[model samples]
Target: GRISEGSGEDPYLGSAIAKAMVKGYQGKDLKNEFTMMATVKHLALYGAVEAGRDYNSVDMSKVKMYNQYLPPYQAAVDAGVGSAMTSFNDIDGIPATGNKWLITDLLRKQWGFKGFVVSDYTSVNEMTAHGLGDLQAVSAQAINAGLDMDMVGEGFLTTLKKSVQEGKVTEEAITIACRRILTAKHQLGLFDDPYKYSDTSRPKKDILTAENRAAARKIATQSFVLLKNENNVLPLKKDAKIALVGPLANDKNNMLGTWAPTGDPQLSIPVLEGLKNVAPKAKITYAKGANITNDPELASRANVFGLRVDIDKRSPDAMIAEALRNSKDADVIVAVVGEASEFAGEAASRTEISIPQSQKKLINALAETGKPVVLVLFSGRPLTIAEEFNLPINILQVWNPGVEAGNAIADVLFGDYNPSGKLTASWPRNVGQIPIYHSMKNTGRPAPAHQFEKFKSNYLDSELSPLFPFGYGLSYTTFEYSAIAVDKKKIAQDEVINISFTVKNTGDHDGEEVVQLYLKDEVRSITPPKRQLKGFKKIFLKKGESQRVTIPLSANDLKFYNSELKFVAEPGKFIVFVGGNSNAEMS
Candidate 1:
């Protein structure tokens, strides 16, 4: 439900991930005891916070909100999501928890969302901080705006009844909200037992079983991306001498990632253990090259709630010396370094989004050892890895890959599995390109796609593009795309366009590829994106095998909200792109 936080900013990825989660939780029946209700989160533009800070103000045009941030929420509702959580940010000029236009007009009436809505933790009371009103007024306003439950605020429990008595809120509104909550409880069979989910024996029977761990491992493997693998430095030999250096190499905790305060990190497997299990013949040695960071103020802020960031008793120089000493006898060095899991989660935003200076120095020293450096980078969001990219190193972008992190990583490192996970969000080269993505509109006098132009919509210090574009990932194996063919160059509303292409696995290993389809309304009444992802297929092929894939596009795919807010499609020339990623080449 908290989808807006972390790296899930892309609408397509958010929808797909939310759909799978909803089905996994509720399926077709909500009454089953094993099933749980899924909540789609932080409704209406909570992700595009000011300066990427959580719970900050979000201001944008209605059209941008409609086309960009609203689809994922709509997708969740369409997938039969059981609930929605209101955001802490303001919608237009009013808080979403008390905005009738957002929760009522747009969500319920226009989109026909049947589920009840809940406020973010303590958001109902916090609306007073947003200068809305006091507790009583905000609670009544939230109810009038169609919110059903007040989470952690207790504003509704204390003031809503009185507000109803005073006619500030209608009795009918309160009754309807209660009825929705009671109805959801009935659907979940909660009214029948009220204690079904709290069974005392379930923990021993279901928590972190071997079957669940296997699924976690598989899922984590699919979420990692190979950012760089120059000359195939990865797929290290089974008998190679590997030096694993970094503060996180031996950590038993922090692998569950952020916001899991109740998670039992004792049950999790660390990277050293996972590597030993998967590659028994390999000799692996580890050293704590650096802490999460060296700056005392930053470390103090990040390590408040847990032991995630462990500042060493030794100085930075001694730590790097130890790491270099260990790397000298190894065939290759693996530096498992990045921000601690606590650094990038909700309510914790950094002005500097990069590897910490202490760890960066350690990485440079490791590189100076002349050993092939493999950066097993872990982050909860995209960090500025430009400086590391300049150095000679191979990078594996692992976003704190869950409980079975080490085993899944070993699977890719030992060639038991090939990396296919694509980026759900774009990686910024620097903080200056913080909000960059693939679906931006073309400007007048647009800069050259490859280089900068003077007096254009370009930056002086960097290219107006991302370091790694959206939907970008790499695999141990290679894939080739043949020329694409379309059934017709132009089609009316009554006709569908059929596009076909072939993908061949040209390398010697079997792997999966995420084939993407992007469509652009080349000419429109209002300016549109250069391209938008319309369809994708994840296909697995054996070495030297080729598969012909077909995707169909209809009029509905091109429809957008016009100036009048009417959903309509303008007929004109269209450009279709099909390839391995968002930077797909059009045929």
Candidate 2:
């Protein structure tokens, strides 16, 4: 569930996205009226909690942390994020809220982060539960750790003054923390005018305008991933008779997604409304095929924030029967099915990452109708969809798209837009492959690409492959890669080399493609990953058009943290792979 909040499973991608987010949030200056300070939160491997559970202990070697988990935080710091929030979990046997090394040495000293540090909601007090200390001791420890602010709990507000009198925490440290907090407020112009950001006119002038919604609609279209398009069932004719069924098909509340607590759900468009708006000439029918989940306990947990998982009073069988009856006469069936918005967000973790059983039954019954089924899957995390993928149907992953959910769905359904988005995280075939990713290091007894070999690094029951690999996506149009070339096979450490390739639009649609490049070091001081994503470029092409794309490789791209924790590029034979996705074949 925590995966929903993070950029999917690769450090490089995570780093890039982190920098972009900081830039988007802070803009060119913090005092700018249109810009807001960005806070990089849950610092230090919160996403790597044990068994993907929230607030669980995290234990890892420095090497793993530096190479895999720490880059994004460093990138955010480099991008000048205004604040950092401590994670709930402990790091190296010390709670991150009170870990001096993490807050001062690594983040402030090593990374040169100028931002003030804040604790997660009540995290400073929660340290008592973590067996750290009582309110006063933990609060003192946190401030000594360089944390400038305490969120909720009020431990600092109530206990710090007494601690200072007792000499448990120095007056100077408290003064320093105060200075950092005041500096940030000054930077945001909060000191100049306390209500500067909350002007009454700001709502009407800046919030929820048509231009914002249009941009949201366009962005929503770009993010939809075409996971499967069996027998070219997608790009459906606008005039075709359609049956839209499932819990999320017409849910306005879930359209704004999980993180938007302040977003007005009523204003968000639903898929049913969107279909009519985009395809007014098409004959469309709608039915609630299934509840988000049939289990009352799960439904209750999912509805903690509100009525996200509304279980119908009707029996599961009755719900499926109604759906099948409605879809029977339609030319095609579009099933908007997956987790409710609350199923995968903060404090929400799932042992079973497949589609809910209730929705699975609805999908299975829809498949029996013999109409071409298109699964408009709504999920916050990559799901185990091997069963659905094998069925004769098309699948489009529309991950709980915000406000423009319905209009964006309609746009892609009628081929007004072709899906160019790719998966950043690998979709596991099953929960057993929880930690699968593209850059996994090669095992000593590596399994073959196909077929599982005994005594090899292969699963006994499942194939050694993800249900959907990282960087994998399908477009309505096909793209073919050829004529791969490198300007220089070898270059000095300071030199940059250009790798070029030809991409042709082999299918009959003008569409976009993200051309990705991966690199593998044949030999290095330490074990190297099978392949790591080095660079990418997004390009558009018309049918039968071909374009040459070039991406540069520099010394920084080749460097990695060795056993000594030094970043260095070892001299070796390196192989480069370029294609549509991470699973691209070597040239």
Candidate 3:
């Protein structure tokens, strides 16, 4: 399944999906000997990769770490996920695989996570590259950091015993880790039947059932974010002459996106198939305008490493001309473009995050046709699309939805469903201004207001901001936010604060709105971010109907790590903002 299958980019969404998937995989009776173990992955600061590159190092204040990245993982633990996977990147100058504060103090002690931690693929060995130490030293460090099992890396099996003998590691730690692994095995009923998940008959009968495919289609539709829908170009008419032009238009393999362990690309449905399923009578013309990627380096590596696709032999310019010729008289053009399956997964990080030149050329050619263009983007990480945002084309960000991706994309395009997905990571204007997020600490020398002097912290060439802020997404219908009322304008310490808002579906069509509630510390021992996402609610409403969404702010929600690195909520005034996205602030 696609990573999107687990959640729709919200921590609350992730928590809900985690509970459902855990319950679906492992029955309500977890004690049953035949239940499966679901593992929540890349525990901390893993989603906000610098420039959307996977496995990149993460640098953030301790307070930012606890406030933003830790919530979903903590929610996963609270959901009772059977296992937790450590991240590949470093947190606060220490590799997450070997960070004692991250693995033990924060995750285990503070969060009360009872599950064992598994190292990301060979992450224990990669610790040496992260400047931690040698293999033996990093292995010992990771074990001591509360990591239990080593996935595919023999770092633990190879050096742990010797480190124990040399007093670098304690025998008790080894016993605890080994016993945790044994306990997991026992929990999965592997002791009763070691090959429970290995049932060959189960794969044929249960892996991709009709009901599962239906669920996949529904989930995929919900995960799509309608980035641009100018003049209502979407909810496309079924009888129109549609030209589906691009390499991925009929690609079965590329539909599954990235990190789909059990997804069979060969059996996956393509966008063309999905369009046909929804608009069977529509006059559709298909053209493979360009490959998912045209870079030689990416093309060569993609085939050798990840989900390989047949490379186009002709030049990209020639292919674009052919596609342009095919779309000369079409009523509308649907351009399917973006990263390939391998371009966004682990070790597939890119320094530059824009559509390849070849695909851009194809889009430019299609744009000249004077036909309304609908652009569908399939990628795992967020892309910097400043140039394309204001184009004459409608855009949708579909993050590598799983097996029934084609069908889901078609469903949204033909008005069979509405898109509700929102971004989980920030989209920067350029790669240079990366490591940008909605929640960032205030430095001593902050950027001066309306000043570009040398002493101030302002950028000379570009704006020090993100192109698309977090918690940002557009629905087919518009919604209005008002009635920003708070229960208490002033509160004492340890008292709960309640914030309420009125959200109405003001447009013609029904839609879902994510009501975001942010809090800012007026005065504290240590300065907090400009604002922090304290609470959010995803609500669905019918056209012309209004709903009241209430968010509770607990004492813990306002707490932050002070100068001495202690979590505490200072007694002070806090600015409460209830709005749509990160930039939508109120007091």
Candidate 4:
């Protein structure tokens, strides 16, 4: 459910997923009676939550928001999502629910999003928490902000009428809101047939149908990231004996991860099932190496949501012994480990973003077997996998890839599909560096690579760098990036600069690459990130084939808010860098 609602962190991946989801929910014909409303959620910067916690406040510069967070939402809007959900966080001291600039001036007037804006559950009421105003005042403010519907909270229905009568809001505002609602209802053909999507027959036949499952499987496989592929150990010999270790080896419940409302854990095909289906002749042995959580309290909490976390019934040493015994004679050991279903998603925040100690111990013991270890990670959020990078194992980050996750992992491991998905969020080495992103503000004295000071803008314990930067992903095939060339080095006030580059697939296999474009405001009234992502393009290419990708930059892309909070694009020498990821650069 979380995967379907919002784009998972990466703008490129999110854009692709958004397009697919919108197409899946609402067919080519917008007037279809059975069409489901695809809502682009949290409009902006909701994913940049402090400490990765839900309902946390977000404070960001307008340039950062526009250059980073708003693009994916804009991509979704461009894909024609039926509706939008306003976030709970505040932007520049104004609650997103009542931010007129964000809702009206930006989304509606600027972006041309005709769909109505619905507040997150009780978000309109939560305006009081955001120090906006009282219920009546806030509701009026939100309505005037271009919010059309209030979800779950009767804020709009209850206070809008009173606000309009009291002169705090105009009747025209209510009519506009109602008109957007009615227009969406009209587009969905809801008035023509109110009972269209409500049919009991379609739910049985269409929901999680074979075709839908196939699509999910294909998408999930593509989403997997093959982090390491040492000595070409993958695509295990079909007839060789394989050992699948860890508690999640055959567990179906953990395969779906979190926020999967309609996902049936029992019906899910676990990694064991997928491997068995792909290589029926191979001897695949499994063992419950360790529980997901050693803490009984956490296990009990996880069990509340019907997740299995076998609370340490046996001693840790015994479990490790059993796992090591299982892996000793196997040609390859696939360590299926990571967080369970309740570890992430709304309110499921974590302080330490790493595999649990108990599971890590099991992995270490399995690694001692000297066999090639293939790590299949099941997670929701980006985890700190720096230590795993040094291990003599091949790791594939399969982020809780829905119901067919097991099958998807198997497909990628066995060369059915080459992993192409990249990291959407930066993986911080430690939890102290909360709210860290690639597009962070510059300080008066930035920390230089060689210069280290106590009061410097960095952590004393850990390096001032993300374990895995945003847009970081590895494919089975390799690609070579040539120097970027711009059509014009300098541009007039309204003139556009065409930046082009050549990306050649230098490997043997065909794969996709996310070409990234970043811009740096060398001179600006307000500070900006060292480099901010401005544009990106995903392209597929065959081996030895080169594609010339071009992206245009306008005055708007170079703009920043001044001291008076006015947006202006200062004319100066701007450094344009084009590459594959946050670290990749082309001068």
Candidate number of the best TM-score: 2
Which regions in candidate 3 have their CA more than 4 angstroms from the true location? 1-28, 33-35, 43-64, 88-111, 125-146, 155-171, 305-307, 442-456, 585-587
- Looking at model 2, the pairs that clash are none
Q: Model 1, 46-84: lDDT tens per residue?
A: 887787778889998988888888888888888989899
| Model 2, span 339-372: residue lDDT tens | 8898898988999999988899899888877889
Clashing pairs in 1: none
- lDDT, candidate 1, equals 0.86
Q: Which lDDT value does model 1 have at 131? A: 98
Model 1 TM-score?
Answer: 0.97
- Candidate 4 regions exceeding 4 Å error are 1-29, 60-67, 71-82, 91-94, 98-114, 127-146, 155-176, 441-444, 450-456, 483-488, 491-510, 539-569
Tens-place lDDT per residue, model 3, 383-487, is 878778757888988877778988899999988887777776568887777767766667778886555667666789777777878777888888888888888
Every model's TM-score: 0.97, 0.99, 0.88, 0.86
Better of 1 and 2 by lDDT: 2
* Candidate order, TM-score descending: 2, 1, 3, 4
- Cα error, residue 560 of model 4, in Å, equals 4.8
Q: For model 4, how does the per-residue alpha-carbon lDDT over 1-587 read when each residue is reduced to its tens digit?
A: 13223555444456666777777888877677556788888876787766556788888867667655686777777888889989888888888988899998888887788899999999999998778778888888898889998877788878877887789999998899899999988887878988776777877888789999999999888777777788878767777788888878888887776766566788788888998888888898888888888988877766666756876679888888888888888999999999887777676777787898889888887776778999998788777777776778888889888788778888888777777887777877767765567776779867876557876786677778787777788887888889679998888888999998899999877888888888777876666677777788889998899999999999877876566656688878898888877877786
Residue 228 local lDDT, model 1: 92
Q: Could you tell which candidate, 2 or 4, scores higher by lDDT?
A: 2
lDDT of 4: 0.80
- The C-alpha stretches of model 2 lying farther than 4 A from their native spots are none
If both were scored by TM-score, which would come out higher, candidate 1 or candidate 3?
A: 1
Sort order, lDDT high to low: 2, 1, 4, 3
